[model samples]
Target: MSVLLSACGDDGGKGNATNTPTTNNNNTTDDETSSGGSEGNTSTGGPGGTTTNPTSTTTPGDPTETTEGESTTDGSFITPPDGGGGAKECDQWTQDCPEGQKCMPYSGDGDNAWESLKCTPVMENAGQVGDPCTVEGSGVSGIDNCDKGNMCWDVTEGVGTCVALCVGSPDAPDCAQPMTSCLISNDGVLTLCLPSCDPLLQDCPGNNLCIPNPQNPDAFLCVLDASGEEGQEFDACEYINACDKGFTCANPEIAAECDPMAIGCCIAFCDMTEAGVCTGQNAECLAWYEMGQAPPGFENVGVCGIPQ
Candidate 1:
């Protein structure tokens, strides 16, 4: 293969500008590349006739020295790893891989080097969306509150600084939170509810109390407590007179909303539906409500009615 050389001033190598070869008086070539030094000069014959060897223009650490289509010791190459079909780009390891190849973690001298070893999905300490508490302390790579899946992208940049483009999963724990679009973690873990202090931050449906689960205080969660026994519920609109005003009465086991003045009165309860809405059950009248719909029920004592 032939290499091109041009004359150009060094810009402190800031832009990796190609260096040029300069000719001298003795019919010899002067190579300014790092590998080419001050002495070896030779003349060779070309197809036309006689030709002089330019100052031995071999560049040190030249990637071209390696054979074509081969990866460096650090798994990088002119091209990315492709299966026989040439379909998918071998990007990540913690997930499934193509038939002939295994999804090994990226190994490189740069930031991604360590990821090659840790190829399992986060399970135990995994966090979900709307969780305010962020990772803290030393020995932790990357910044806190990196959305939901953008954590790994930050790793590729500088362990702590966030980057604009990332190749891994959008749910990689580094992405910004309240993530509208993302797959579950490799282990299918997710954040369901957030702290209750701010209604906007609350992940549970309206009138439901989001509290720190006594079982796992570190994880803030949402649970319905109709008995008013959950130590003061907040933001719930009171529909039943039994409980204090301003708090929606909710059933512990089932998600049902009841009004104090309506039938079924304080006895009706609230539950969370699959679609993330608060629902009510246990009305003497078996009226139909959409599985994920949130609308007021009927009225009358013992009759299922929407919470006030």
Candidate 2:
């Protein structure tokens, strides 16, 4: 009997729950993908792989100045509509702001005004390539967050910088600026900009490596190579790479009678062809492809598991 294993996939966004595994023969659809950092501004896969509407490119005004009935970081004066109650402040969700400002909604965390909308200054320059950005936070970094046509990639440790969105052909990629490489995510859903690098020679700057694109295997992107000790089986892990190379962060259902974690646990990789590769007495080596639709390059991958 063959066992199936379910794992997480990278969606260029915050990690979602692990997909449940199913039993079937060849052509089984495994919805599992790899896990990574927080979500980006891009849309999920649609019919014909079409992306949703891109972020707005409208520039915000000087973040320093404060407008009447608008919220700001600086200490300023602005009485509510009529001393206390007249016209409500702007509604970011409804885009209800004064003519000169944009509705910058509150993120509800870390010093942000929860459930409140503020009329922020509309600057002429926003969403430029290489500008610093944050997915969820007050714009205190001086750099305007993603405005339009740009997204904050690799959102980890509570920060994700800006990167221009790449559209069009995968073979003939067109990034916002020249010299930027169009890199695809592991789940083959998103394509964003990264500095070009040579994988064969491993000449990427710092600790980054040129890894093959999961969607388009022919293309490569500069990423951090797996290093350090591998996480042991059943250890808590944040993302796929958080576990040592050759191991995967998998759903706890893979283990017989084991409780699942909100994040996931590190599972040892196994070869289905060989018998008893999984060290767990109750665990079996299950082909990832047999469970569901494995990512493009993960069809042959297997994980230690117990039949679900």
RMSD after CA superposition, every candidate: 30.3, 15.6
Q: Give the TM-score of candidate 1.
A: 0.17
Query: What is residue 209's positional error in candidate 1, in angstroms?
Result: 7.3
lDDT tens readout by residue for model 2, 93-180: 2445666564432222222112233455545555456665454332221123565445443333234456665655534556657656
TM-score of each: 0.17, 0.37
Residue 188 shift from truth in candidate 2, angstroms: 19
Instruction: For residue 127, give model 2's deviation from the true position in Å.
Output: 5.9
> Clash totals for all models, in order?
39, 21
Candidate 2 regions off by >4 Å? 1-106, 111-147, 153-160, 164-231, 236-249, 256-263, 269-277, 291-296
lDDT value for model 2: 0.33
* lDDT to native, each model: 0.20, 0.33
Residue 197 C-alpha lDDT in model 1: 30
